[model samples]
Target chain A: MKWYQKHRETIVQTACLLFIVLFAYAGLTKLLEGHLFYDSIRNSPILGGKAMASLASWALPLSELAVALLLIWKKTRLIGLYGAAVLMLLFTGYTLAIVFFAPYRPCSCGGVISLLSWEQHLVLNAILLLLALMAIWSSLKNKGIPWKKTPQGR
Target chain B: MKNLKLILAMLAFIFAIGLSFAFMGDTGSGAWINYNGVPTELELDPCQGNGNDCKVVFEDDPNQTEYTVYTDDTLSQTRKSNNPEPYIIP
Candidate 1:
């Protein structure tokens, strides 16, 4: 128990590790189904049209890769956490649109995870976002940084 | 704390930019069709499937060319045409 308490940071690190792994898997899957993802994005009201959708199709995968890389590096872990959280939020919004508005079901996020329904995908994103937020909060709090610190520290 | 907040804000901005670009590039739907004498190829809508089979019928001449391709499967149907004008399966 004492040993576990002493290595509590490891638990936080593990949470981050899990998030990175999940995103990396999802990111790679998206990259593989790049064309289908591009089609969905192009059809989305938020994503406007084909030309811009193509650009986004290219960027999203790279961004996911960047987030994974950042999380693995001690110097960039916080940045990665923030990036992952924001990406999840965007994905949540996109999933909501499909659940509420879109008439057709998009391709299953392929690769190792297989196919998932829109609602299931949304839930997954939400859970990941929550985990990421918790990890980021704990990391900052443990670093002796008070949540409500004054502009000029006490 | 300040740095954390700043990083979070920056991430939010990046996401917004990404989502904006995605929205700007949206294309509703599209398809392609290639009818060459024997086997016809079609780019179908993802949802238009019957169990494991995919159905494609010509919009202009439905009776002339009717096809059903299995999922992840191809269809090969021959049509007699001496001077063939590439048929477009709407």
Candidate 2:
């Protein structure tokens, strides 16, 4: 058997774990530094309006945590993968817009990730997006695992 | 074993959370400043000394725009000298 096919389940599980770690860390930090996160959104060129920034500040961290929770269980893993891909796409799009069109780019990411410049953020988001897509594809191909519980609930 | 991998993942998650807490700080905290009539975003660290000592670092190029920020108790009272050293973005 091919190496990837032989280890497909392990690979997919690892990808899920990575997503969980990333989202949980991101969500926690954003919540911890709520004022700074809100300020970043307020100063954002795309969503600079007060109301929009206010709404996004709360929505973003909650959504990230929700995605991480979804990825924790076998039944919700696919949905979580899709959620992660969508979030990554939005992040990548925002970074691309800022790099190409914004008046200036600011490092809004908290913690160690804030060290990455906008260009680096674009590359990292793109790579993560690809990883999410690949994991979803691999997961779909491996359909031997049962989705429903047996009568005995084993 | 599957359980061992799960345990390792949980441990990594815990480590990540701890690291996040350790490194968390005000990264993008700043106010918009009118530098020589140009609206510039500068990261102004809290001034511990008399307000004149606040080093205002330019968001894009810190070295080029390194200048002292003088502000009264409020940000609205902040002022910069006319024709201050022009910052060249590299």
Candidate 3:
């Protein structure tokens, strides 16, 4: 077996750690600056309107935090990976839509992520989505338990 | 070993939250209008010279007759100026 195959469990653990940090940071930043996040949502061309903005302002950040929590425990890590992958997929799709279809683009993304340009946001989201998919595949291959199998057990 | 992993993950999560809090910008500083009775979508300024930090106008306000421009310098006497002139949208 290759070094990576031998260390698959470790790699999955590390990826899960990365995602927990990313989601927790992103969520907390949005929650901390709730007013700014609300303003951003209100200003979005695609996501305008008081009702939509209000719903997203709370939902997006809370969802991220929830995903982080889910990833913290081994029993729920598989579900968390799915959530992260879905969220990233949605974000990536939104970015693409803004780039091609929107009359005017306004980024409602939170924190340091808002500083990135549309192209950079796409690249970053794509990378994150790929990582999330890989994590899910690894977890499934291990039957959702990312532990090494003993020779006798195998 | 499991406890160690959990502790490390918790520490990393806390550290990330701390860093994000430290870098968070001024909240409620940007200008925004409630899109309650807007008829048409307003244009967003291309944000010339300003790096991603700016405000946006969503729609025309039927009740608002004057637009207030807030300057950054509080010491400057013209901190809040009311411009009654109507905006010409080209």
Candidate 4:
């Protein structure tokens, strides 16, 4: 128990390192193949067609880069984690819908990450969400709560 | 100081990951097919090809050439030939 507690910091650090690495890689790939990424989103039924997809294409990569940067910053780590968690949750839902309902399989994410089956994509997002949660928890534990409850308890 | 160090380390890690991804490029594992002969049926995309009709050319040079792909308005795609003999299609 003592040893585990002592090594917890290291473990958390390693996990954060891995999470940052994975997201950065994914983000950069989307950035490079911006057009293709947009096309996938545009094709998605969840987006309700091309216009929304185009908007996502522009928004997603920038959001990803911002989240990854925040996760790496001590000051903004928790916020970044929450943001990433929400994004991953959305992605997981979308991928699962495609797997179960979509008539055709669109091109899998390109560049470094190739065409992954919907199931595989879901699993990847789940793992990322878990990692983000872990990092957020660790950050909160290390730093005291940022805000105090109101005297009247709101 | 410790927090700063941690942040720096995380940034370095992320940047490293991004660099690795950029280097990997396209893995070419998609549903691309290599046709051996003139394709009997070719799906043409107006946006990608030269208008509706396009011609692809293969050129050969005496010196061993590096692998490079070239595309122009007149030519949809071009590939360098391995053999010295030049073949042109009217």
Residue-wise C-alpha lDDT for candidate 1, range A1-154, written one tens digit per residue: 6775576567557766665666665566567657656755654444546577778888888888788768766678888989988988887887787678764444443443335676888888788888888777767766866757678856
Each prediction's total of clashing residue pairs, residues at least 3 apart in sequence or on different chains, is 10, 0, 0, 0
Q: Residue A138 lDDT in model 2?
A: 80
Give the residue spans of candidate 1 off by over 4 A.
A1-8, A44-48, A149-154, B1-34, B38-45, B48-90
Number of the top candidate by lDDT? 2
Query: What does candidate 2's lDDT look like per residue over B1-90, in tens digits?
Result: 867755655665676688679886644434344566555554422222121334444335635565444343234554432222222111
Score each candidate by Cα lDDT: 0.58, 0.70, 0.67, 0.56
Q: What is the TM-score of chain A in candidate 1?
A: 0.81
DockQ of each model against the real complex?
0.06, 0.20, 0.30, 0.13
Q: Over all chains combined, what TM-score does candidate 1 have?
A: 0.62
Clashing pairs in 2: none
Rank order by TM-score, top first?
3, 2, 4, 1
The best candidate by DockQ is 3
Query: How well is each residue in A95-149 modelled by candidate 4, as lDDT tens digits?
Result: 8887787644444646445556668887888887787676667666567543445
TM-score of each: 0.62, 0.69, 0.73, 0.63
Q: Point out the higher-scoring one by lDDT: 1 or 3.
A: 3
What order do you get sorting by lDDT, best first?
Answer: 2, 3, 1, 4
The top-ranked prediction according to TM-score is 3
Task: Write down the RMSD of all candidates, one decimal each.
Answer: 11.3, 10.3, 8.4, 11.7
Better of 3 and 4 by TM-score: 3
Write candidate 2's Cα lDDT for A86-144 as tens digits. 99999999999988987545434567787788889899999999999888888877876
Cα deviation in Å at residue B50, candidate 3?
9.4
